[model samples]
Target: MMNGWIISAAAEIFWREENKMAEARSLEEIKLDYAWKFGCGRYIQQREALETLPEEIKRLGDKPLIIAGPRAWEATEGRIEKALREAGIEYVLSVYPDQNTYEKAREHASQAVSSGCDVIVGVGGGRIMDQAKASAYFAGEMTKARSGHFPVVQVPTSIATCAAFAPLSVMYTQEGASLGSLRHNFEVNAIVVDLDVIVKEPARYVASGILDGMAKMVEMQNGHDNITIEEFDVGLVTAFTLAKYTMETYRKRGVQAVEDVRAGKLTKEVEDITYLNIAVAGVISGCSKGFGQTALGHECYELIRTHFTQEAKDFIHGEIVAVGQSMQLSFNGQEDQIPALREMMNSFDMPLTLKDIGIEPTEENVETLYQDLYHSPFVKDCPEEAEKLRKAMKWLCE
Candidate 1:
């Protein structure tokens, strides 16, 4: 009986060791199963960057469809056509006349298909880029019927937004009202930014870009607590570093840069700020992923859109977001930062209060804006802060 009991004990120890080995193997398998998705364009930003487009185009295909807004086409059509002709690359130029709407995107996509273009090149500011990117995506969807997708290249004429580097595009109605966004599974194949062209753009566009970059940096910093450990990887690290650099650069030379650009003299500071706007800002935004924040200000833009006057309809995106940032700071109990932010905005002629953007600070308007904020996804991060935001809006009116 004693021998039998000892044998049973030995068998139990052997089974325990086997289970441990199996558990270790399972962990190894789990590690192997881990995957991550990251996307960004092959970015090229420099003076005369457009000169390299021919080589880039050859990599994709000889036949390219160039899409641009009216103004952008007017500014760079001669140079673009010259480059294509010099390279002996066959191409078709299409001007997207309407807003960045789904309908317009589909229209352009049909044009691309009928033109037998193998590549789509988007050139312009945020809206134009979004339209082109969406057009490429829709074109791909159409081609999926034939089992393929068209590659897209982006050439930004203005650094007003990161639409050039972003893997998604914001959609709007025909009248330029927000209708959320469309995300693509892939990034643009390449992005080319010609400093010469960008410098020639109005300083106001660059200023608006600065303000937008500032708002994004501030929001991400303010909401760092919301970032999970898994989300705080190299991407977040790079984003934070770039954001901090952008803020510092703007603080030191933002005013001078704007002045120089307005004077048609692209000083070193102007170039630096331009690069910050077009490249660094886009990188920071792209790398931020789940850790990024787009609350208060972004939501406010959508809420107050219908309230904009016809003249105010031309208001730049960053200007509105800058004001939204101030409102957010007020709600977040970071009021001390508002004065400096306001000073910066004032220096660049950015809007501050609701009245500045053509929105009357009436109780009805305030309530509508607040209700929109209340329903936003950001509220989940600060459920109790809605009252604070509401009170802040009242102070803004005052």
Candidate 2:
């Protein structure tokens, strides 16, 4: 009787697995037909290939407008001007004071429009690239009929987030705040990644980026019920693989990678990090269309309405996400993983908690996040997961 029962139970388990696999496969077939293209292109050699600008700039437009963060004012404006001049491409420069704020992007866009810029050249970090994208779209709001105007050439200083290379850009109202919103503003016409510039970025930014890259893989394992991506099986698996490789690289390298980057020691391994940071991640975001499939471990946008003081919002973008990921892991009954994660973060001295980021888990913040968790877009796609998220958030707060 026991043998018979065990055989029946084993058969039932196999049947369930078959059913779930069928569902996952069914979900994979649904793809998005849209105007977007992404991949790694000639990133490591853009600067040295300056002599070829005349032809490349010509492909983008006759007149190009340059948008850069304040930090890149000296580096980009002078170098870009020299190149554009050599190429005989008309150009103007718009410098944004801050990198992460939508208001700053809006400000720069307003300025760029006033100057009658037809094409955009984004030079700086992801924020500056995002700003250029938003500026390009917002400027031609009235005239952007079907095909958008203003081709944007994205040049990222730090291979942090691939926002610069995607059709969508993440906008923030201020720093240390909630990710304001993800807007489908501009598409990348081309990307110019000078590895030298990438290596110069701070180690902390690179470390935080490792966490963001890992999130793509971790979240994909628990697929979402809604917002399905076409050919998601391929896309998800590819993204997962890429993210896994990057995370492993960072784990093995630690601060040595960061130090090497700062010292301009761009090795093959570091080069791979840049590709994951800028190339593969961007391609995943663009082609995968896996928007709502991956459940955000951090209660999405809950911190926006109540927590995120002005000072906190001003902190680094990836840092906030890093802390949020830890909180999310705790909710998943994966607290055991926290020590390993913390050790990795400590390598770059990356913030691993809300307290580390200069924010406290106050009752008010908890309540707001608790309430917001139910209505989050990702949560609505999978209610069961949302419930788990709530449980997780509540426990973490406790």
Candidate 3:
């Protein structure tokens, strides 16, 4: 079953060299013209910037629709409403509790359009961001395949995923649980990050974001074996580079870097990490140029299919992806690395094993993963050289 693609000494050398060249390429050096503006003329990071929201809204034109998760509205609604009132801007509020369900997307859009919403502001985590983005699409900001239709302002409460600036949305069934598919209707006109709000969350969530950032690199690299150099996609390259930088940033700084976040201290390093996770990573994923080249943790999708209940999917996206990344490493025949990876998971208090996440490795669970493996699209995309990965996964679970 070994495809005879041996990892000889030379192979490692080649991998190291290629990876080095790939890492050296910068987002600016590439021709992606979309300047993902992160800060508040549209995006405000501080209370002063937020205080100026009224003035800014006056400039951006009149009617605005505030699309956000319940949590986002709960946390900042009063301040937002107060700012709107003081600014004399007319706006309506729409709460998006779910992602890509047809009914939910329709409801949000209809509400915003009916309110004569000319500008859209999305506040909160990835799910809310996605719902806002999808609703904007329905509101005629742009078609699903075109550039943005209307201006959008995004304020991220969590740094856990790249959803804030990305044009893409991960729609879920209504009630906010099951995931549908990745979507890209339009990109954000601006991204606002309040370090204070972000820092207030558990440190573990921040660490999980770091892990998600790292996975962007890991999954993209794993996807590259399927491409040629001329065919090399910018999105994949950007994702890989972002991941590399973010991983190194976390690996070196450890808890102190995260501590700074918890303390609302925005260091140069923290900004870099946050930008990578939010802006750069989002652009890479949202843009069509990178969509085909990117590989997700598809195996995790299958595993979740076997275990995910409506109630469980409500957890943070990073939590699922953290476990997915661990699953990806294991599926790659890197069993020896599990202990190290597990340690990494434990450092963030992430669920380290199937058992930890509440999916016990019982006989039925083992059979399910094996049956699903044969049909896995992610497996199909793996290099012929890595075909043994399928067998390895089966053997490991056995």
Candidate 4:
């Protein structure tokens, strides 16, 4: 369904142009025509979740290309390889660089084509998941594929973000500014999460995952925070409801989830929290169109991410988003909820201030954040809005 109807290299050029054009357009102009890949990831949370991989892969493609970082591959390779071999499935293993960049996606896409791999399996956190999805999408343009993507299977090794279940890859510059998202009309062919594997990771991953999932509620509801839904996109309404429920669930059970993950034990709280981070948050992201799901908090993350790369070296996307959430809660005048959120973050050792993350609120740095927010093309340029961002960020740093 290309507008100009080209293929191969021509299609590739057209795709890049299309992305730029999308970035240029307003959210109101972009339309989604009934896009949902899957309800969420298929659930099989036992110690044997990898056992289902062979069946899932065979359902989509005969040859699979597994994408991962070295550590992620090392952690799950034994189980993953065992499952595939027993089922007589031939698979290719490719490791992405530690640097998550578009060029790497292009490199992997070319590999997918040359290796003749029919499906992609992302076997890690957000970076690997996004790269695999992006590579599959780009490979569709590289070839004359009908759906413009090879089927993707997501196997989440950590609960950092919902890239595993989201219909789009969160795009970023090599230097870490947001380039919006690479949205897919199709969903991943399947998703598999093994709790035993996920629980062994650091508790911070689970905590960060919770914060990232919570962003869906905070950012999406800034404009449409109404509980009594009247008239709207059914998908949008549905996503809002899910986020609300997820938030309440977190309020009740998230602490326990984090503690259990820290203790390297699987429990109901851990399971629900893990799914909320991947599936529920992902649905919220997939249902959102254009900037419909973005607001001051998310925008703040994009606007300031590159500023403190040194300080943020060990940081994940959700941790930075937590800082932005402060700006959002303040800017949107949702001040009453701040105390509880602040307390929770403090308890989890999550950053509640710029200093907490090793970022200084020096005059020069603070002004940069303020100026970027003030001049952002995404938001209305007004003194009041600028002041709010300033106040919010200032409070966060202080």
Candidate 5:
């Protein structure tokens, strides 16, 4: 009890001090810095990988806090629970309340701080992993332990996105609006990718993940000359390099892997493609350090959340973004790249346009889209850009 009290008081003091520092610091007085950091990214992609959990991971902490997706926890509990018990690791499990938002992350972080957990675990798909990272990061801030950064271990039950390995969280509001991406200062402690677990998830998740990973390369094309980090941007060049290879890998192996997933076959193609989407794409994001043009495909998805609010909720992030990718490319006069992308999206059953997202191509819908597009961040304040956006919306509605 005394220890807990002391820790709590210390956390309060640190929080107060942080606010004071923030208030005192000026924009010009601040000196920004970033480091190339890496974490223990492990891939245990096998039939019973969890059954043979790594020895290094067993001792991550004496007491751990786990934030899990309901389905994911149910699917992998027996295997992981037994392993944790065997290793004498005690864990507190909290089912994620079906949303990955900043509020939820802070709530879990408070739980971690109050529980005095030394390590954090996230089980399930993309949102689960992202929330885990966010919680761990916040836990560190709420507690002085671990130097304001708690280690996070991810157990991904689905290959839906790179959330498992990326040192970032794509946050959303309780109302389901895109809060955009939140990149963390630290990397993930590890990722336990059990093939046996991933094969059980819906095949669409794999396809969606591939389509999303494909955007890592294409979306980078936007905003190079727009709002971006200033200074030695060697990381940007390296990020693009890896993103190019990530796209190439996707082009070569994406279809076969999706088919393999659909068949529930644990083939080499599935493993490679899964890792590419998670690990490789994660590295690309890490290299970018959350800088450069972020407002393109994802921005379009946020716009959809507003325009097609109800229907947009039915589709996953990547599928909507796939539609946005086409719009993004088209808006930028990069229509030459649209055909092959659309073909691939169609093959994966991803939405090709706004109509594919279940909206009627009516006069009302077109006008609504035109108004939004004309004033969109990427299009507003420029007559030529507004015309481009109008044309793109017409094409998408068709």
Candidate 6:
């Protein structure tokens, strides 16, 4: 009688466990029912790629508005004008200020509307593209235009960020502080990546871009355990594969590619690197839809930007992010990976310590940083993890 009772209890426990597993699987399937949208319908990346812009512009419309930064305009004005003239396409040019703010976006949108422009072409770095995207979006809303009818084309002058193909724009305050990001359903009509134009900039931009691309992969890898099997669809898998390719390309040919660009020589390696930096990086983030939620490195950046404005202004996006990645690795108790990460960053003169980013290792500053990190949304779901990250940051400063 005692043996029979024990057997009955074991079977009940096994049944309950199986039920729990089935429930979890059902939940994941429900989540997968939602679909994600991918932006940037067309991508033209190659040397002399600007030559292809006339065809793209013709497809969008006859009346086009060109939005660009002052310096970026100076660099590409000749090619753009020549192309437009040859194609007999009339365009209005609007040069935006250095800042990337909502007000600026609205101002550009007003210009696009008043000028009777049918298509918006953003020609510059990330900020310019972001402004153009926002302008096109708001312009369409104001005019009561159909969705996706008022198209925007992104022509990237630098590979610093994925703004060229991303459907979102990162907003900032008038004081040059980050406000957060804004998402739009509008898709970029096309992307023209002229390697000749991009290589004209310094090699530092390329290196920073590569690191930014790598960060997306690192974030995904760090949070792999949390992602469900249902989330591992073709888009997610392709994103992961692209991230890996970006890292491998950088490790194998990045140094020489930089040298070739510095010498004003555009090689196949440079073209491949640029492709990895812009398209691959952009697509990964676009498809994943912030799957890993930026992990520790980006969280640190947000904290510092919010609290230590003066110190944060001196560093570019990717430079500070590299330091944050190192801190994140340490936070996760993956100290063994730190040496290689630091070495790669150091080779490009990226910051590896607090002082490197212009922050003193004073106790007061460290405490402030810790407090900012503690209250960040990245740790909102798990407050205890914030403490762990704060300790890791403290050790980094020390």
Compute each candidate's TM-score over C-alphas. Answer: 0.84, 0.77, 0.76, 0.89, 0.83, 0.84
State the lDDT of candidate 6 residue by residue for 130-233, as single tens digits: 88887887788778887843788889998877788876776565656555455666668999988879878877887777677777656655534323456666
Candidate 1 residue lDDT tens string, 2-60: 10011235433543332221111111231111222233457787888888998888888
Q: Which pairs of residues collide in candidate 1?
A: none
Per-residue C-alpha lDDT of model 4 across residues 311-391, encoded as one tens digit per residue: 666777778788878777766678788888888888789987777777777888777666766555434556666666667
The top-ranked prediction according to TM-score is: 4
Our model 6 lands, by Cα RMSD against the true structure, at 11.8
Cα RMSDs, all models: 14.4, 11.5, 10.1, 5.0, 7.7, 11.8
Q: Evaluate all candidate structures by whole-model CA lDDT and list the values in order.
A: 0.70, 0.57, 0.57, 0.74, 0.71, 0.70
On lDDT, the leading prediction is 4
Query: Which pairs clash inside model 2?
Result: 30-230, 31-230, 175-313, 175-314, 176-312, 176-313, 176-314, 177-313
10 residues in a row with least lDDT, candidate 2: 18-27
How close to the true structure is residue 187 of candidate 4, measured as C-alpha lDDT?
76
Model 2, CA-based lDDT: 0.57
* lDDT (tens digit, per residue) of candidate 3 on 1-398: 00111134643344334222221122333233243322223444553344555565556558878877788777664777887887778888777665545456667777766767777778788767766666666666333324445556777777787777665555444444333343443456666676656656566667767777666655665434432346665544544555566667667764565777667676765666666667656655643243332333534542453245443454466666666665565555455756765576676677654555556667786555545543444455345634555544432332
Give the Cα-based TM-score of candidate 1 against the true structure: 0.84
Q: Candidate 6 versus the native: TM-score?
A: 0.84
CA deviation > 4 Å runs, candidate 2: 1-55, 75-77, 99-114, 174-182, 222-234, 262-264, 290-294, 297-306, 331-333, 380-387, 394-398
- Model 5 agreement with the true structure over 290-381: per-residue lDDT tens digits: 43323457656766665566777889878877877776777666789888998888898777878788878788876765665454444445
lDDT of 2 at 158: 67
For residue 294, model 2's alpha carbon misses the true position, in angstroms, by 5.1
Query: lDDT score of model 4?
Result: 0.74
- State, as a TM-score between 0 and 1, how close model 5 is to the true structure: 0.83
lDDT winner between candidates 2 and 6:
6
